[model samples]
Target: MLPPLKALPVFEAVARLNSFSRAATELNVSQSAISHQIRVLEDYLGESLFQRQGRYLALTQEGKNYLDVVSSSLSHIARASNQIRGEEDTKIRIAVYSSFAVCWLMPRLSDLQHKHPNLDITITMTHGSPELSDKTADCFITTDTEKRGFEYQLLYKETLFPVCSHAFYEQIKNTLNVTSDELSKRLKDEPELLENFPLITSNGIYNEYTEDWRSWFLERGIPLSNNIKFHKFSHLILAYEAAKYSLGIALVNDYMFSDKDTHSALVRLPSHRIYTNDHFFFSYKTSRRNETAIKALKQWILNEASSLNTLA
Candidate 1:
């Protein structure tokens, strides 16, 4: 027997988005209307589809299995409708870190536009890793490797290093009396040099507390000073900006420091790079993996990440 066709859209939207209010907004209906349709669908299926815990909504195991079928079938139906109506543009929404969007993806976005004029993109910048749900975005630039019912493409491995403003670099480059490569070696070998400047830190790196500097120092066999001065910021971007203004040397990574931005203002101290278990992956729901918008963006982003990873 066929499920209630009309109720399926309501269930899919509520399930994918994980919010009755948001599903109502997307469906242009009332929240009560969403709940009613969900009840109807669950009753027809003779099983519970959603588990409610206070203000949050989550899918049951059966609900998750059913959604894979429903979302894919609905997408194909919508694709057929778009084709019949001669639709030209497809919008792809992405969730990414604020720093990566500014430093890497922003400048190169136009190139993606040039390559695929029929594709529209919307970006939702995030401070930390967001949960994998349609409400987060249709696509995610995330470090999460869990693949329950999602597809992933490896973007780049996490690479850690420190940077200071070119202004700050000039002040110490001659004092150190060493080539850039040799300076990097010194930064790794000479822990005492840190006494000359303060360390800028961020809690946003790898969702850990001040591990950015700690990892770089420990990874390079340099010990953190007991009495070193430190400055902290809420986000990695803030720390990067502070470094650009010569506030101090901020521990950063290649993902945060890209060649495409106005990065000439910053100097890379490549003495040591801490590579962690973290690696960025471009992820999307497996059911929608074949969508034109998702396919195009995945290929272009993979190419871009490949170029940089190859260079490094």
Candidate 2:
């Protein structure tokens, strides 16, 4: 038999927060009620779950062990309850950066809707890397590598390559009598050949300032030349435009190119493609990973990511 199942939430809340008053506030009950519920659990278990130390509460050894089981069991119960209530009726709120929304996600959303007609998703666009918390949104597509309570599934690592306008692409072809594939091979034979043209890159888009260019050159053991003409833009989109309009070659990410085949003016140089530690991930709460709504969304995102990566 269950030992006062009604008190589980109150116990979990108080144990997690380590404060009876905070748990009472969270559970929307009086502090006395919180005490009564905890006392009921202690009476049932015949063991102290928490010990007080100067103005704060700490979980005992038994409480620590019990918390792990309690948390998992409660999560399972919550997920099951949501499933019974038709979780699909609620929209899954996903937060992403604006650039991703514009360059990658927007194009593929139609396909997603067609494929999973029942899966409802609402997008929230953020300017910078989103500050994720319980209140932020249901899921996040971000470059944040930090592991929190959330489960992060890497969508793709950012692939850095150079691109230029058709006119510039032709000029390079005429001048060198070779395509980018050939040029990439030639660069390995003579690294100095890299200095022949202007280079464009963006600022503040990576972990370090202009790590895109640095990483590309560093990966190939090519020394960064100080004499190379550099055109710096405040953002990657501006740099992409610079490269699109015959503004020499720009170091760009795969997402910026989205579907490279579609861009007539833009030509990808596909140089030893530098895959960076910087990645875009599909993240959600781990506790809800098993819920049907979350499972469907996770599978859809994984499928889409696989398709996009394969196409790229």
Candidate 3:
């Protein structure tokens, strides 16, 4: 007995083009192979599926009925196969700004892992404008307000302040107690302190979108100086650690500090609260919304964000 499945490719191609030679060319097989498959299919069905006229082939009544079923089934199989392959190989790359990665997301990553042990997450530290459409990241976690066609989930509204290590603070306590102005002057003049301390500057390159050390100091009514010496590390976490090790006082987001790490030390400097309300969102390609992985991601992010009271 001949199998219907074995002849489906030949049948489908011939049905589509209405010619045996054309079907053979499309399937990348010899014309004789196409003829043999069709003959086998016809014998199995006990009916002539196509009517030959000159060199052309036309579907008979039986052929038309079979073509409808076979074509629909083949299309469905193709779609299913593609979906399965996409799910296995697909990566959900998320681009996040430095400070947020260190202070907000990194601490909470365990929660995501507990919920989705098998899901793959690719995190890249990108400064300002993750460029979602350009395929830089599947999702962007940014402070930007104008994100279109993305499923925006507000992770947290950040509050920024000064933080330094306990050991670093102890070394400067007598000096800091003199007066706020005197301490500020000392910090500005001390080149070694600045060099050792990760100043916790947000942007590697200055962009209008990024929050800067000068902006934060200006907001606090402190004047900017040319003599202030500090090393610039591109990402927020590196800066955070530099401060944690007593390198220098870093004006950083409050969100990056973890209460649980015994070795991790951070103390907020005496400054007024610096608050910024920005939302982070998960965005997928619009065409990919229906895919299983995309759907899974959307639901997972929504659920996690909701519990944290960060979802918008």
lDDT per residue for candidate 3 within 102-164, as digits (tens), equals 666777788877776776888888756676642355566765656455555565565556678
Task: Report lDDT (CA) for all predictions.
Answer: 0.81, 0.76, 0.65
Lowest lDDT 10-mer window, candidate 1? 255-264
Question: Which residue runs does candidate 2 get wrong by more than 4 Å?
Answer: 1-87, 145-147, 177-185, 207-210, 258-265, 307-312
* Winner of 2 and 3 under TM-score: 2
For 1-312, candidate 1 gives per-residue lDDT tens digits of 898898999998998889999999999999999989998999999999999999978999999988877976786688778867888338878999888899789878889989998888999888778677764578899988685888889898877677889878876777777777777788767755865678898887656656777776776566777777888888878898999899988877776676555637787865656677778899998877877788899999998888656535
Worst 10 residues of 3 by lDDT: 189-198
**Winner by TM-score:** 1
Residue-pair clashes, model 2: 0
Q: Tell how far residue 193 is off in model 1, in angstroms.
A: 1.3
Any runs in candidate 3 off by more than 4 Å, and if so which?
1-91, 98-107, 124-128, 134-137, 144-148, 177-202, 205-211, 225-231, 258-263, 276-279, 286-292, 295-312
**Between 1 and 3, whose TM-score is larger?**
1
Superposition error at 239 for model 3 (Å): 2.5
* Model 3: lDDT of residue 4: 70
Question: What is the RMSD, in Å, between candidate 2 and the native fold over all Cα?
Answer: 7.2
